[model samples]
Target: MHKFHKSIFREYDIRGVVNETLYPTDAYHIGRRYGTLVDSRLGGKKICVGYDGRLSSPALAAELIRGLKDSGMDVVELGLGPTPMVYYSVFELDADGGIMITGSHNPPSHNGFKIMLGKDSLFGAEIAGLEKITEYKEGFGSVTKLNIKTRYIMRLLQDCIIEDGYKIGWDPGNGASGEIVQKLCKALPGKHFLINEKIDGKFPAHHPDPTIPENLEQLAELVSKNKLDVGFAFDGDGDRLGIIDEKGDIIWGDQLLAILAQEVLAENPGATIIADVKSSRLFEEEVSRLGGKPLIWKTGHSLIKTKMKEMQAPLAGEMSAHIFFADKYYGFDDGIYAALRFLNIMQNSGKTASELLRALPRYYSSLEYRIPCKESDKLKIISDLKNALKVKKASFSDIDGVRVNYEDSWWLLRASNTGNYLVARFEAKTEKKLAELEATLSGFLAEYGYFLEV
Candidate 1:
């Protein structure tokens, strides 16, 4: 009934439009196959399941759970919650693994599963492997559903709040986060303002992602309008954070990681901080300035999480708002946890968000530019662009995409792993250097035959 093949499965996770690439029967089959795989890999023989606020999430989660349980894997249904809550349930329950049904920041039609195997990100090829077991049409198992929301809530409150309370703003964007924000607010002693708290599958207010400046515009307004210290926005699934200061600036994902790592390194001297190539060079510099080692890793929550576990890094982040803290928590990316940590940092740092940004100046940066393309042509563009850059002898690293570092600035061009777009970022020390970096982009675009408006 399901198209059991690699087409639906992707590098980071399993994702596709509902009824097209991902159907209910497909979800059921994938669940069974996953259960079989878990049986062989993790002896715990149990799984935690959670879903986002997507239109198709409930059906997908139900059928997916049926598949997992049909393969003899016990299921703990976490109901509708953010992806981070599902991840937290996995770690706290001491289960073998878990799956968060989420489209992430994709459009309303998209939905997928964020996989975890023995507490590590089961992504890329690992996710692609879902087809192997389903090819044989594995046996069905039983699902025992148990609500774990309370346990999950308590885990978030565990040793999270700092000594002093702080005022804050929370915008769930009418997504799944509202399910728990009410419970979470009970533990924190702060004057909190919540917006779009309704768990609407349509995401009527705005796209559930905070990383995109356009998506976070409301939270920025909420901060200044409420006279709050800061505002926090979560993606549809709650694994990514979009932060807004009282002054209405989106304190990007990389910057938030820097702020968190600064707190971490003071306690654990010279600890490693991992960040994606999309992050500014200043992230590395800041980590080093604080006597911590910074490693530039590829972009993607799953990739960063795996690398964080491998390197045992205290902190890891992507510019898109996926921040991981291995030093104090279970190390998987959790936007809610990251928000709490930011508040804790504020309590300790004794500086407002605007003041912190004013003080931590280094380079002028451009927002991530997403250039659309056919998914089929994405790899070809990367290859062609790589060749073009090679002819110029411009120094570059394919760490995530092509990060060509220059004297005063750097430009990184890479294809998105999850979607059909070439994401690029540029940073420079001066306005002149910025233009130069932007100029280099046009040449690469022309060579690749991809018209990108800078």
Candidate 2:
């Protein structure tokens, strides 16, 4: 029996540093366990497996497939592509379950698995149960290799109807989305300028996380140099997205959500639109103004997806750039698909990206701040903070974390589900109020001996 580290099984997925917290043997065990779960519990036989551009992904995927075959589970092998392609295969191929071997926005040295069983992601208690599996079934199972790239691209193209030939800039940041971006651009009606389109596990051009403003410098430069209408960037596994306007100013995730919501609301009035708790107040206000019901839910992608299903929401997004559209397509976060949807909106509106997004009310907002904390202490700190807030009679929502609401400002502090850190953000109508809110949050953390610097 392999003794898997508890830390690797996160709230959302299985992830860890390669050869350290995670290994080939671990991947094999995971496959054996997951295959058994799929067959015995879900009564499923076919599973689709895909990998990202990470160097360690192929070997891990190969071992995983072997273990799955050993457990008598037939595998549809999606050779190499983004995480969303694996998700697409589940629906397009009508498979029982799926798994994408990716590290997402994490560094090159890390790798992990994002899993689905019957279209819904395996998370929370389901993920926790993987550690307890001790038995594996042995039998012969077949493997079918599949190339889903062209079909996936065609699906995206068919969904979007772009008539305008707007000059667009794209930066895949040398991640899994590189090839897909290149192919999609060729088919779309636009003057496309793309950088770092080569799929490289090393991520030579920059870190693949577009959420970090530093990583988007190259894309901004590309947009500015060409005087393009807009720019887009993708993360490591091409699940999250980042955007730059004509002036090379970044359209943050909440702002982008506001733009997308306008189009969605027009099509489906009074439809529930979900945003993560970390999203700005402007998003909620905009959705309400557009006659759409706004819901602020938990932060993780899987959690949000489940909530979307429960509420039957047409559109949903996070501050981290994970946008899901159930309006006209499958409700999975796909960077390429989102980029096209935005392009279609731009084309139909005959407006520049800046003009389309300029109407969103602005606030003095801080970028997401991550503070390192021990995995063991993360939950405890949050619990203590909540208790402290309760005693103070603070106006806050504890949906995912504690988001303290004020008359003209709000701030959020939550433990990151994917890492050993506490993530925080602040927004206010004025800079002084933003500073005051930061101070208030810092003072609260000080009680727990976690001093924060604004």
Candidate 3:
């Protein structure tokens, strides 16, 4: 029996530092356990496997495939690509399920797996069940290697109808989205400039996460230097996106979602659109004003995806830049596809990216603030805060954590599902209100020995 670290089995996926909390043996065990679950519970026999550009990914994927074969589950090996490619392979090939070996915006020293069972992402309890493997199978299953890149690119390009003329910049940040972006750019009609297009596991250019404003600096410079219409950056596994406008300004996730929502609402009026709790309330107001129903749900990608499916929402997004479109495409988060959609909107609107985004009503908001805390204490702190809020009789929403709502201001403090930190955000009609909300939330945290600076 292989004993695995409990910390690796996170709420969303199995992830940990390589050679420390995670190893190839652990990957094998995960594959075996997941294979058993798929075979017995889901009545599935075949599974698709793919990996990212992380250095540890290929080895982990090999061991995982070995374990799956040992457990009598056939593997369709998608050699190397973004996480969404594995997801696309699952649907395009009509496979039972899929798994992508990726750290996904984490540092180079870390690696993990994003799993799916029958088109639905396994989360919370399903992910927890993978911590132990009690079942075993004897037969050896087959393995077939497949390259779905061309078909995947074609699918993305099919719906993208944009004329040739605009100047655009792309920065993959040396992550797994490089090769596909290179190919897609060739087929795209425009003056496309690319940087850090090589898929290197070391991420020599910078960390692939665009959510951090620092990561967008290079792309912003590129856009500014070239006077491009817009610039786009993708996360490590190409699920999340970041955008830079002509003025070298960062268009945040909610802002981008609001821009896309206009087009979606124009086509499908009164459709339900979902945004996570951490997103700006302006997104909710914008959606409602456009004749679309807005739903605020939990913050995790898996949670939001599941909620979108349940509500049959045409579009959904997060402050972290994970945008999902189900209106005319598969309901999965794909950075490349979202970029193309944004381009399509830009071409049709005849407005620069900044112009369209700046037209939206703005509010004073803070970037996501992560307060470091022990993983074990994260939930406890949130629980205590909830109790304290209840005693105060404050108006708040406890769907994910505690999002205290005011008439013209709001603040959110939630334990991050993927990290040992409490994530917080504040927004208000004015800077004064924003400061008051921040100070209020800060006072709450100070009681718990966690000091928040601004």
Candidate 4:
């Protein structure tokens, strides 16, 4: 009997509330199954493992390592660090695959694994297959402890090109990236202010999600009080970034992507730049105007990275702040690396963050609004809604979700791949049009026993 909590296996990664949905036993099984797949099919023997600052991470990692070793997969334990460091470890050590034990932006009570095999992220059907494999092959495999912190930091700072003096603020939200952020601040040539730099799994200051406005409050306050040039915040695992400007203005993920795109497109014209369907149309248009091809794809880090490689795109980002850069670095989402790249862009431009973002044409848009729905019902609602739109002869793109294109704006309604919720966002030329679209979406939702709250 090889039973496991099915809910933990999401579209992107495995995540669950610690000790409840996820247990040490689950980690062991995951390692056993994943290791078997690697050894039997992928023909890989060496694997790298790393964990975040979450309370249960250490125990989970230990069990996972034991299982991996038992399955005859040599384990390279990378110890405590952000998720990206683990990604880097795989590449640096030339390991066959890597597994990062991180909850990502989830709450402190949550913990899980983000997996990679030979530069490929495992999700969807690949993750699901782990449950079906009942055979657990046992053998004695070696475990090696490696301190990769110094090497990781040096690699991150390698491409950093910043002008001598500029003050900036940073908040790690007491997540896994704290120690690295502290070290990075010391190495850089500028006045660096940081908060919540201690790697406390409890996340004592606030929740680690930077996508939510409230979580950026501490960084915003610090930027304002110190009259700093800008501020950056990281999610729980440090794979995503949240930025605030010198004036304490929140620069949403798309806006940050747009800014970065300008610089990247300048160097490599006609390059394809990808963004998630949840991003602003303005960003897509900006990419086109900057002599680059803009592609709107599904919202997931794994999906985006895969697309980036396929399109040979130099850059790609999502509204959730998972920015991938193949311009100078590997195509992986690393908030710390993105921050350094952004700083380099700012330094070269010799302009304030406000000036850079404000110059872009403004469009009124709504934040991601979630409508509660049962997991089973969520996709069915979307399917029904798609049918309704088709009957009405609506112009929309169903690439990932249904993004209906209007004359002056667009609206997107997509079932969340990671959870049991329908995520929506709308944009229009004016508030009146926005209101009308909201009503239109609400009408569709009402028929499915759901309502839009925003």
- After superposition, the stretches of candidate 1 with alpha carbons farther than 4 Å from their true spots are 134-140, 163-165
Greater lDDT among 2 and 4 belongs to: 4
Worst 10 residues of 2 by lDDT: 445-454
Q: Quote model 4's TM-score.
A: 0.98
lDDT of 4 by residue, 266-321 (tens): 99999999999999988987898899999999999999999999999999999999
Candidate 3 residues 289-374, lDDT tens each? 99999999998888888998999999999999999999798889999999999999998899999998888888999999999988
Candidate 1 residue pairs in clash (backbone atoms < 3 Å): 11-124, 31-67, 32-67, 69-141, 69-142, 70-140, 70-141, 71-141
| Better TM-score candidate (1, 3) | 3
lDDT of 2 at 62: 97
Pairwise TM-score winner, candidates 1 and 2: 2
Q: Note each model's CA RMSD in angstroms.
A: 1.9, 1.1, 1.0, 1.0
Model 1 agreement with the true structure over 1-454: per-residue lDDT tens digits = 3455446688888888887777888888878778878877765577889898888999999898888766777788888888888788777878888998988878899888888887888987777777766443345455666777787778777757565456788988877788788778877787888888888888899888787788888887878887889899988888888889888887888888788887899989988899999998888878888899999998888888878878888889989888888876888888888888888778778998877666565798988888887888887877877787799887889877788888778998888887778888899999888878888787767765777687
Query: In candidate 2, which residue ranges exceed 4 Å CA deviation?
Result: none
Q: Which residue pairs in candidate 3 collide?
A: none
Of candidate 3, the 10-residue stretch with the lowest lDDT total is 130-139
